[model samples]
Target chain A: MATYKLKTPISEEDTRKLKVNDIIYITGTIITARDAAHRRALEFHREKKKLPVNLQGLAVFHCGPIVKKENDKWIVVAAGPTTSTRMDLFEDEFIKNFKIRVVIGKGGMGKKTTKAMKQYGAVYGAFTGGAAVLAAKAIKNVKSVEWYDLGMPEALWVLEVEEFGPLTVAIDAHGNNLFEDVQKKVEESRQKIYQKLGV
Target chain B: MEENILINEKIVDDVAVKLLQLAVTELPRDVKEALQRAYREEESEAGKTQLKAILDNMELAEKTRTPMCQDTGVIIFYVKAGAQAKGLDKIGYALRSATRRATKEVPLRPNAVDPFTQKNTGDNTGRFVPFIHWEIVPGDSVEITVMPKGGGSENVCVLGMISPGQGVKGLKKFVVDTVINAGAKPCPPNILGVAVGGGADIAMKLAKAALLRPLDEPNPNPDLAKLEKELYEAANSTGIGPMGLGGKITVLGVKVEYAHRHPASYPVAVAFQCWAARRASARISSDGKVEYLTHKVT
Candidate 1:
């Protein structure tokens, strides 16, 4: 319901102050990780291997960015969020293991992730779907990348971003979930449509 | 023979690459207008913010010649092969070649993967990738449309086989339920394409084909047009809004297509196109004249 500007490595206290429906613009480092990257992170964690970057207090974006090599430097062309629901399986554990503060993506996650956020003091922010160029505009630099064998989209992309979102807080450190709230409203309307159509 | 080779390989490749560029970077006028209308009309603040971001992203993408979305999507070519056109057989090959070339130039995400090995094709070309659908028509010009359908909308596709007696009402219920079940997953303010009748596979094809139609056009069939309008209204009533965060305009449009089915069957299929509906097309004459149907090219 309110807007705030935050920088990362955010503390638990920073995440705790936000509520579902609050708007936030982040100025910090956020890494891109999708389904494959999520699975690999968990697998690597179990194997007791070192990750390319420390995830603690960072925003883990559910994104598979479009990137290109330009004069030997990697540039992010369009780095919008991928759907987050696909990572629902690993997210609770990801939060528990990584101590990350925010999960950024399109499409909200499920109950398990919400519970993890409430327990671990994290939040879910939704970037507009298909708004890739705007996303790239905010990405000041592609600081580094990993897991290139999983291909560009699935690889771990380290991005340095500035004012990187109008990311609407859909799930917060408390138990509030905006998607669940909207689903209830939709169900009520679905009934009326059925009644009128006699279906 | 030289003329044939030039048209099939070079002209087709140029057209295909340019079409891909335009399709990904620029939202079609009708679809852009629809999003603008949704933005102006959306009452909810969250929905408006979502729409504004979408519009701004679109503008930036166009200005910078960047892909509008990171997904870029699965490449599909809906081709109108003129029976009278020369080198009709090579159109498919040309499209595949063009896909590879476009993949590098436009830098499309390499989406095609070998299912068994789980490895990407790197060039966006693989077995049955680019998924061309061919239609033969009564002219010397071949029309090609490139619709890069994103995964979010593709995941929400549904098929229903209800009792034949339920008719339009059954179809209505099916669509409403599908959209609700999809929630925010498909990215709301979506455009839905519904197909009724035909066999199951045909029904699915018809439904996806329905999405190729522009938002500005109503179904030419009067009864179907009315059905489209009613479904459009029913869908928006769900108030799923942009990204399903809650708002009044859940769907921008609903298009319905039909075929006569077996008396016992009432197969219905629905395909969803997310708010970033992207497509562009061009037609090439047998004599080598090119007409850009969707957008004017310099």
Candidate 2:
């Protein structure tokens, strides 16, 4: 339950120190990416094509924001984390290729992602799922955006943020995953519940 | 011998916007109270933290008049139509116009996407969107309720047709299994709506409609009320807790709705509503007097 404030371009060593249940607040750059964004990023990696922006040493937020153009600038209205499990298929490859240090999202990722975190040095931070406005308060600017053709939710949104979190490290660099841990206990309890219900 | 006010497109459009505003920006009183209770009863630090953040987020959204969650979700309108109400033909156009207006004015995220093209409609409306369900009732007042169905929760809704021999035990097991399999994905602590004994479509429709029930209201049928209580306890006992981090509250409540079966077919549908649980309703009389049913709006 230790708390930390970290800036972007975080080193592998820094991510390695994070443990399950540790609280972290990140300041600096984070990009919003969901299902389509992940597919495109991986497609580009396979083709050896350069992406519009380099994501190395940064945080990737699983979010689809409500944004509007006001006076020729983008204003982020609500930018909360989407369910991270939706991106589980792409996460392993995305981490290996992009070298992102922090992954902020809700729910949690899968075994592939946990193994990747241990190998490449990354942590999964769980923000409260429905707290969109609070999440938006930390965002200071839309640094830039790319792949608008993918639509807002699936587009790549580069954002500059302040101390933007209260994120719990649900998966850490050492292969400890809070979600998997909970799932195991839930299975054990379900057996007992089934016995009682006579199902 | 009766005095009735004429209903028109203008009034319908204006009222729809007000309903949309309240639906996205304000959580209902019953839901807020349930979350507060979960916060007080939560045992683990992770559960406590999640509930606290949710409560704080509600206050912020209400104060700032912004959306509580980014999804804002797909717009759904439930209409209880009055047979005697005028301008029934204008309701569709007014509601569609209202959806477009709210997308820009309420700044609601345009979430409607065409599955074939994989392109967003950008205004949250397309073919059959802002999907309306109409029920004719014996009254002179038209009531409209709006529920924004988010992708996370909607993605997990399930339907199962089981052998009639399995009966109640099998039905209950299916629900608990659904909750376990859903895990943290639907963003538990969830409010579950379950429908039994209808056709697949009917069961799903009834299940979603059941979610409009306030948390404090139990089913009038004593047997159904008992079933809801048992399921609610079973879900909370699993320790999925808030955000599924393992604690004392996996579900805030369970709501069950059912139709008499076809003797051989037993269809069960589970509708999952995340902890946000947002909806608002309004009733308009023939004389055009509007009353906000869910929230106290000025």
Candidate 3:
């Protein structure tokens, strides 16, 4: 339940201090990646080929940004977090191999991801689900992009942002996941709710 | 008696593009009011915070003319075309052309990809990417509704085939279980459209089409309305709250639509819409006049 101002290239130490339900306002650079980009990154890792961008100590955002090309420059129109769990299968490996310290997305991840967060000293931050315009306003710049062939949603977008969150710490570095907790609580109280409804 | 309404192809094109633009940039009045109501009644600070952010985002998107969410999603057209309307054959081409224009102009994220080869279409339209569903009505005007359903919520959609003996109770259990299982994935404070009794595909279509109705409006059937109310209360009581951080309002509204089913089958489908709930509609008269039903006619 604590509030923090995080400036990236964050460390394992900084991420470890984040507890589930805590709030964080993040600053500095973060990279965006979704399904296809992660798959490509893994392929590159297996081949021992150097990635287009170095991700050490950086945060990764699960987002598919709406960008337009104007005067040879890319303008981010609507950049919001996508569903993070879609990347769960590749995330643990993505975090460990790329040294990603913070993960920003909508929705919380599952057991494997939370386990990876604990083991790798990473925390998952959940942004408001449908707030694309607000997120776009926080971006200071689009530093560069890679994997243009992967398309907008799957491309690697390196962006510079300032105070880029009010993100809820859904999965903390210690493996506490708010989503899992809510599911358990709902299960415990399910009978009472159903009875109240007379169903 | 009506002299076959001569709907111009050009008018259909203009209306379709307008609907796409309006759907992405503006949160309809009913949805905005519902979110405001949820914010007012939310009991938890975390839930309130989530709602506040969403509201702020809505405001910014409207003012700045930016999209509400990045996943402009697959553009779906629900067309209630009139049987007597002229230029019926040209409607599909107009819708597709408008979709491509909107992909660049509304600047919708290029979401259409080749499923087999994994190649982005760059424009949102591919082979049936801007999916169109046609239903013929008695009227002579074409009414088109565009819903920009995001991937997050669509991925969590559920279809269940329950035993008829299980009845309403079984249907209720299926719905509640689906929402709980969705957790933060579909984005809480969601709008649910539940369809019961239709065949598999028809049930799924009914559920999505149900989302076209305003949140303030209840189902016309008393039984369905009652079911919606009960499900809303039960879902909120789960405490999944907004963004699943824990709160009192997991679902803002639920709309139920049911169709007569075969004696041997009872299929239920739930279409989960994220808090964004982006949709808008317009009608084109045979004389080429256009009126936006959801927003101002201008």
Candidate 4:
């Protein structure tokens, strides 16, 4: 239930203090990447090649943003978080290879991701899924755009952000899950509703 | 009254493109205001924080003329064509074309594809471009509504066929249980649309169509209206609150629609909508004139 405002390039100490279900308001640098970028990064790892971006102490946001450019400058239209579960397959390898400290998206990640967070001193934050326009306002600058062939919206656009989130800590370094907690509460409430209705 | 209606084929494409662009670029004024109000009244510190982020995102989208979310969703068009209108087939093609253009112009995510091959069609159209649903009515005006339903809430939709003996009370319990069980997965403070009666498939479609009704509109059936209120109250009682972070309001509202059914069947479908709820509509006359329809965009 504790709260903290995190600036990116987070430290092991900062990550350690964050427990599951805690609320975090994040600011600073975070990169956006989805399935394609994840796959490419893994392929690079498999080939033992030099990685594209420096991964140290960085947070990777799972997103595909709608962006437009004016005078060669790219601006985000709506950059909301995509479902995190899609990344469950490659997350462990991505985290381990990049030394990623925070992973932000929606819903819950799987066991492999949880283990990776615990081992790599990382945490997963769940931003509201449909609130893309809301999430995009936090970006102050588009530092770079990679994977242009993926199109403007789906491309991997590195962004500089400020006061970027009020993200829920879905998974923490301790391997706790807010999604599991809510699911349990939901079951309890379902039972109560059934009892009240005499069904 | 054998009136010949001249349907302007381009009207359909224009409407579809406008709807897709507006769905992302504009956060309707009323929706923005309501969300802001919710943010002010939200009691959970966490909930309020999430609300603020949403509000900020709305502002950014409006200022930059960007869409509200990355999952721009499948473009669904509900068209009520006047029976007198000619060229209905052309309108359908227009819709498909508009969806393709918007896919690039609005920079909508390439959400459409071959299910088996997992290959993106690139234009956002294929088997059912724009996912058009049509109803021919006896009128001189063509009405079209566009709704971009996101994956998160769409995944949470469910259908059940309760026995006739279960009645409306059972309907209420089922709806509450569905929402409660959904938890944070569907992204609460959601809008729940319930469809009663009809067969399984029709019930689900009716439930989705019910979402097109205004958020504040009362159910046409008095009994169903009462059930809507009750389910709303019971859902909030779960303390699922906004974003399921815990608080007073789990659902913003519940809308119910019913269709006549068989003697023994009582089909029910629940469609949950995330807070974004991006939808818009337009009405076109046989003479090619058009008027914007207001639902979410008041």
Candidate 5:
């Protein structure tokens, strides 16, 4: 219910204070990663090589950006959140390993990620799904990229962003999940609504 | 013998490129209006906010000529080629070429990949990518409709084959259940395409085709139209709302189409399109004239 303007690297205390339904506008450098990028990061971990960039206390967005090459630099033309559930398998480990404080994406993550959020003082912010152009406008620049072999959607994009969201805090550090709560409410009301319709 | 109209390969290529660009950047008029209405009708503050953001995103996308979504999607083209169209043989190649060029130009995300190798195609064309569905009609003009099926909604598409004994009630259950189970994953204020009573594949295709209709239009069949309305109400009543954040507008519209089925089987397919609902259409005549429809400017 409250709106907060926060900059990264966000303190563990700030993340722990967030509650589901709180609005957040983040101004900071956030990296973008999807399934491929997550796998590659894990690969980098196993190989004992340094990641292309440091991730501790940084935010990782679930995005596959549409980027164009302009005069030898990359331009993010349309960058929107991808479905976060696709990263469900890797998120818990990623968060524990990387100390990522904020995860932004669409469609929310799963129970494992929710548990991770609570245990690790992290939060999941749900950007409006399909709002690619709007999301891109928040990104000031594509600072760099890695794992290009993973393709655009799966590449790890290191971007500098400003006031990057009206992102809803969907999963909070207290273990409350907005989506899970909504699902419970709907399930509880489902039969009653059906009966009223005489279906 | 009727003389065949020779369509140059370049014409198909040109039309394909234009159609893809328009589909990616512009919100179809029907969709724009529907989202506007959703913004007005949404009672929840969060739902309203989400709708407004989507509307703003649509406008910005058009202004900047950037894709309305990052997915840019698995490009699917349905072509109704006239019998007299000579380059019917070349249309597939033309589409692949057009898709490849658009990946770099429109800068569509390189979505195509080798399933086995997990390697990106770099271009958007791959084995059966930019998937084409073709039909031969009697005229000398070719009509093409491009639907960019994003992964979020496409992942939630479902096909159910019910026993004929289960009847209409069972079919309704299937559709409602699909939407509810899908929850916020497919992206709400979604446009739902429901196809009933074909074999598995045909049912799925019919469901996708149903999505091409304008949002406000109901099925011509009164019975089907009633079903569409009923499902629409039932879905919204779930209160899954926009982005599944909880709201009154879970879906914008329900479009239903059906095919005759065997007495033993009742098949239902549901195709979910996010609020973006990106599609564009164009027609090319024998004289090499091209006309674009479904885009605001064209």
Candidate 6:
């Protein structure tokens, strides 16, 4: 597995070739958002209004993490990725609207997302679902947080991250899905097991 | 014999918040060790990679005292109250208050809402902030277990009622089929909790309650325990593996709980827990004392 330190303004070519086990050390501007943020962003876009943040070469993570303040600074407790499927409804639109280059989440995105990635020069990265603590380590700083009224954890916290991954390239620019590929293999194995059991 | 046992509302709230904090910050010892073992034994390269990442996350959460996942989950409190206990409503109020405080303090995700309006109260409290399920038995003290049920695994829960003719074999087939159909939707190497008997609602509740039991802990009934073992073996044999990648271990554990049912109805409910299996519990006494019950970690 190849390893690369990714930064904003990343080219589609570099991200497209990323493999399943490749470890990525992402730096630059990464935004933390989940179901609510995505929905709001889409609503704003529909109204032809400026979004809360710019999307170009940006990485949007599917997370609504818990945070605590110590000495007046916010610290991530468990920032593990949530399931990405829930965001599937708006991902393609968000990707195209924002010029987002990398999407970090768990599970896998759908066909529209894959097509959008290929067409728009983006890549989908899969962070481990329950690995919030590990993901927090990659977060070097919280640049700012919008919707503080949404509470410390659920608020959309803009983060400046560094060396952030070990994230899998589940959906490469070419539309190959590691999750689906692996799942197919598993089904085959299951069939073999059933055969052995003669059930 | 009239027994005197009364718990204060504040005490209930305090305990709930503490439980929520622990659920997010601390990786139970048994859970941590099991993930480590899974990491070592996982043959699939991808599965091993995922397992290692989870372990790293656990380490980070503990060291930093941050939550292990962004989806802190809905707070589910399973309370078994002693028949002698007074002021049960106080316990409910405490749970609710604790949920509100934890939303701000523990920084839990705002999970509760108005079912129709689709509005998020943002404090993780609205109608039914702390979903409380109560069981009153003839006893002296109150025992409560808190499970932070995440959306991913909760979505995978299934319920069905079969005729008596279907039997245990039919149940096995249904369970396997459900997991296979679930694929990676609920996340894999999951803990499958099955509740048999009772009516539809009761069966489902029991399924969730079954999840409160520690991983690898056998059921009280030998027959049920044997069934759990069989299910666990069969689930893994499905080759669903970790994260649904092909591997030897599909399910980490299987737990089954049962109650007597009506003659014609055989109700079944399956609750799936992701690899994280985030949960914790505490026992409270009438004298306002508490004992935090830590589950076997790994």
Q: What TM-score does chain A of each model score against the native chain A?
A: 0.96, 0.95, 0.98, 0.92, 0.97, 0.91
List candidate 2 stretches off by more than 4 Å.
Answer: A39-54, A147-150, B1-3
Give model 2's TM-score for chain A to 2 decimal places: 0.95
Q: Which segments of model 5 are wrong by more than 4 Å?
A: A36-56, A93-98, A146-155, A196-198, B1-6, B84-87
Ranking by DockQ: 1, 2, 5, 3, 4, 6
Candidate 4: segments with Cα more than 4 A from true spot = A1-5, A19-28, A35-49, A67-76, A89-97, A110-120, A140-157, A174-176, B1-6, B27-34, B86-89, B295-298
Best by lDDT: 2
Q: Evaluate model 1: give its TM-score.
A: 0.94
lDDT of each: 0.90, 0.91, 0.87, 0.79, 0.88, 0.77
Q: For all the predictions, what are the DockQ values? A: 0.76, 0.73, 0.64, 0.51, 0.65, 0.48
TM-score of each: 0.94, 0.94, 0.91, 0.86, 0.91, 0.85
Which residue pairs come into collision in candidate 2? none
Of the pair 1 and 3, which is ahead by lDDT?
Answer: 1
C-alpha displacement of A13 in model 2, angstroms? 2.7
State in Å the error of residue A23, model 5.
Answer: 1.5
Candidate 5 residue-wise lDDT, B171-258, digit = tens: 8878778988999988888999999887999999999989999987888899889989999998999989999998989999999999
* DockQ, computed on Cα atoms, for candidate 3: 0.64
**Candidate 3 lDDT tens digits, A120-179:** 999998899879899999998899999989877689999999998788888988879888
The docking quality of candidate 4, as DockQ, is: 0.51
- Global fold similarity of model 4 (TM-score): 0.86
lDDT of 6 by residue, A1-199 (tens): 6777888767666677776556676888888878788888888899998876777887898887666678988776557777788888989888888888889987788888888888877888777777777887888788888867665545678888887776777777776777777667666666554553344
Which candidate, 3 or 5, would have the higher DockQ against the true structure? 5
How much lDDT does candidate 4 score?
A: 0.79
Q: Give the Å shift of residue B70 in candidate 1.
A: 1.5
- Indicate the worst ten consecutive residues by lDDT in candidate 2 chain A: A190-199
